[model samples]
Target: MTATPLIDPFQRTIDYLRVSVTDRCDFRCVYCMSENMTFLPKKELLTLEELDRMCSTFVGLGVKKLRITGGEPLVRRDIMTFFQRMSRHLDSGALRELTLTTNGSQLEKYADDLYAAGVRRINVSLDTLDDQKFADITRWGRLPQVMRGIDAAQKAGLRIKINAVALKGFNEDELFTMVDWCAERDMDLTFIEVMPMGDIGNENRLGQYWALSDLRDSLRERFTLTDLAERTGGPARYVRLEETGQKLGFITPLTHNFCESCNRVRLTCTGELYMCLGQEDMADLRKPLRDYPEDDRALENAIRAAIALKPKGHDFDYSRQKLDGQMPRHMSHTGG
Candidate 1:
């Protein structure tokens, strides 16, 4: 049976769902969370079985692509079981893709298991390549560990994409170096503008904001970047490097909004459905799911209600030397 398609208020089909399985991570990235972080209580988080049911419900509602994320999704205990169960959606052709975004610290252990469970591609959040700089950025991440994980993933036949958060005065000097490095490894690279979210202990959001437009200009000096009209069901806009022939993507949520064509929604580890990443508006699906555990109708209706209130766009502007439209929750809380 064909499930009723999930269409938002703006007429965009909500087929992509990013689910945060846990709010805990081993590496506390400077941009994502504070060095000394307080994670969500385990009791408040949905159990792995609950997560499976919630995701399965979304799949029944026509969510074609599912991306498991977290502070580091691999850190979750027995997370492979969730992936193994979700693979049923793929086997039935109900889901097109099942992937995850990781910090790459745990891939060495989980990469083979991820492939066996149906994940063919993944996005690894790597801000810098320098070992010391990598440690400084991720706070607890070791570059060698991540590199080993990347090697394992590649060896396991999983496609890899490097996601780097473009920070001013930090990775600006490594622009060419990063691109060339990814190109050499045959991995696609994406540069994202720093979003204004949560408190980073002592770091200033405005100070770290790096406009992706400036970075694009810098890339133009070295490579012939021709804009490609292809979207991977997300906000990234792609460009092919004429020299290396590899694809480069730019996710400019601050400098350029990609909301008009937004076709996804984020589900937190606690089962809160966030209509927009930049907005605090969220619908508590947990209450509905837990209150009516055996009632699929109630869960479906609750999801539909949330989709109806999905905002047209996010208001994340970093202009005039100020950080406007900032959210109080950390990126790790909602899954970046």
Candidate 2:
């Protein structure tokens, strides 16, 4: 009932799909967002059925992993109904694993139903441990709500990934504290080096982010840190506390760009296919899905054309430069 999965001229089998359901988000993270973002009109975004058709095509091609994201995926109106449709379309076995990344503002209420509908795991974006510092960074801080979402996810039988963006002067001191908080709950914590995304000329931008090596050294002074080989297409490299069973992951995108094994591709909320995070070029998917609904070949061909154009990687050096100058869309918008 499915066609072969799409593959590019390079012969890499395209399988993973990260879809942005909506550009609307509840929070404003400094580094990855731009306030001036004039959102796409509602009629332009892919409807549920249209999105399902694309997802089915990808699954037929060879996609085994599917992740739902957004500026905050939960911010999409009627999100629960969307999940139900996606769940019925793919089922648990059709897609190897289905997951989502949320800002945690609404997870407390919907976490259980989200899991019931087919999401196996949920990752929450949480920057700081201090309430005031959290507010200062997110502009509204809502740390309590974020924490409650974490608890809700744990209770819903979903594996938790607490994503922490390490800021140097803000709350970098609490990196291990954040780790311990998750360790106590048996959840994993990943510390990301705030990536330089979006327009750098924007005003409310980030200052400096902590480096991975430096964080390892600091954590070693207190807890015995050990390396683990587990990793994925994601930017984070894993480390664990020797005695506490606490794990830490470092995403050093700014210093060491991991582009060689870049096996994934992204789909924006409006249906454009972006090959890399740093590049501006993208292929239009919405046009074909609507215009050539009967032509599967055309849709697959367009995707291949985009894949052939995937750039090598990004150019970033935190020591001498900052990636904060010109931001791409917000991280939420890009499904980060």
Candidate 3:
């Protein structure tokens, strides 16, 4: 039997859940994490079986869309096993969609398996197409390897979307180039504003910030953008390019917030439920999951309790050249 749908205090039905399978990644993007960082110990992470149970519980509570994220989800050991396990929910019609966000580093090895497991679309974090700039942006990423992975994923018939972080003075020159490239390859693109998170100093955060409004104005010089009244269950707002007929998305957390229509929550690999991305409030679900291993009643109650405390909106601000409402946790910690 399906449990009652999870709803927040503002009467928003929580139907989407983003699960972090691991806290480790192969690349350390400049805006995402520090060059030299320490990752979580494997012992602290929830086992694959435990993750399956937790996600299944969410499905039972009417979570229609599930997105598996990570520092890089594909890099986790035996990660496809988790995708394969979750496919059961998709097959049973309890879950509407099952997808993931990756860095495109491991897609070459797992692309076929991901398609087999019911992932029709995926988001790949690619900041720059220039090899040298790509290397600089992702401290440890090789542009050629990522390109090969993208090729493999395309060959495996997975719909790809490129997610780029808009950094001032970094990829401003390649804005048009990126749009043309995605149009040629039949892939959608989204530009995200860098959020104030992790070990970033105020000076660095201020330096890297790029407003999407400025970006939109730049594109208007060369293209016609038509606003689309559709959302993909995430924070991105879409606009269709009249010339290319391809969709472009913008995630502007600083200039404009999308928390009013928020219907999602993030779950860390350690069973921590983060109600909002820009806020520090979270609930530890690990204890309840382990304590009531045989019965899911306590676990469900805990999830309900957490949802009841969900805030109406986040307070991420970058006004007057000051960084405010910055979270201490790294983006990778909660699976950006």
Candidate 4:
């Protein structure tokens, strides 16, 4: 096999692609939706065939890692079929890692098939440990069931990772407790900085973008965090707590600009490829798919175009333009 040339906006070859299967989710998490948020029409979403073709083209273009995301990926009807087919493609070596990031509400029933299908890992978004708090934050708490999904994924032998967005008021109290939980089991606990992504001014207001560095500085006595080597996979910086052998990751997108080493491009649920979260500009991929029927040089060239256009980094992290009144499209939509 020949090497897929790496070419990113930062002069690095981009190899990561996050594909959003749908812009719809079952949960109405506070940060993700408004009291009156309307979902996208089914026809507006990328078809399974369109998605597979795009994934295959991008994989051929050197996207070694592909993450499936959704409003809730499993919320899509008959998602098992999608995974069964996608897994076969990923295993064929068009991609290196095929992973999914979900809310875990619907993973219990699908874990076995997903694992058997070739899905390599799972990242479950569970912010609060308290059931009521989880309910308050997610609106449809169902903490017990989500926990069940986590157990199911683990039992299925999926490389499970827990992603908790450490909101100052929501789950700030559980920061260390959560870390201890992951440390005890050696499961990776990732602290994702709440990003400004939507338009729900009141619900999505990022009033509490706490700095992880400060959180670490304050916890110097309890645990020592050692920085790990820089590698790009997800949007997090790696660090480990001393003596525990547990990985502690901080995705400080709001406070830190990690664009120099940025090597990712994203696909929206509607089949548009976004080069950066902050930029409104995107290449409308649905048109190309509608125009072309199969994976050809044109399709591969489009993937290359998207990769080559991958931004050096996002500038949205540091903009102080008062983010208390907006949320972009929700984490589920962008696969954050």
Residues 230-284, candidate 2, lDDT per residue (tens digit)?
8655667888788787878887777677766666788988889888777777899
**lDDT (tens digit, per residue) of candidate 1 on 124-237:** 999999999998988888999999999999999999999999999899999999998998999999999999999877888888888889899998898898999999999999
Clashes per prediction?
0, 13, 0, 10
Model 4 pairs whose backbones collide: 6-13, 7-13, 24-71, 197-327, 197-328, 198-327, 198-328, 199-327, 201-325, 259-313
Q: Which is the better candidate, 1 or 4, if ranked by TM-score? A: 1
Pairs of residues at least 3 apart in sequence or in different chains that clash in candidate 1: none
Over 1-336, each residue of candidate 4 has an lDDT whose tens digit, in order, gives 235675875687678888888777778787766646677888888788778777777776677888888778888877677777777656677678888889999888899888898886888888888889888888865899998998888888888788887677777778778878777655788887777777665753456576777667766768777899965476788887787878877888767777677677778888888877656557878877877785356666666677666656555643565753233556555666
lDDT of 3 by residue, 147-175 (tens): 99999999999999999999998999999
Superposed Cα RMSD, model 3? 1.0
Superposed by TM-score, candidate 4 places the C-alpha of residue 92 at a distance from the truth, in angstroms, of 2.6
Question: Root-mean-square deviation of each candidate, in angstroms?
Answer: 0.9, 2.3, 1.0, 2.3
lDDT against true structure, model 4: 0.75
TM-score per candidate, in order?
0.98, 0.91, 0.98, 0.92
lDDT of each: 0.93, 0.76, 0.93, 0.75
Clashes of 1: 0
Q: Mark the 10 consecutive residues where model 3 has the least summed lDDT.
A: 199-208
Candidate 4: where are CA atoms >4 Å away? Answer: 1-6, 230-232, 317-321, 324-328
- Give candidate 2 regions above 4 Å deviation: 1-11, 35-37, 89-92, 200-206, 322-327
Q: For model 3, what is the C-alpha lDDT against the true structure?
A: 0.93
Query: In model 3, which regions exceed 4 Å deviation?
Result: 201-203
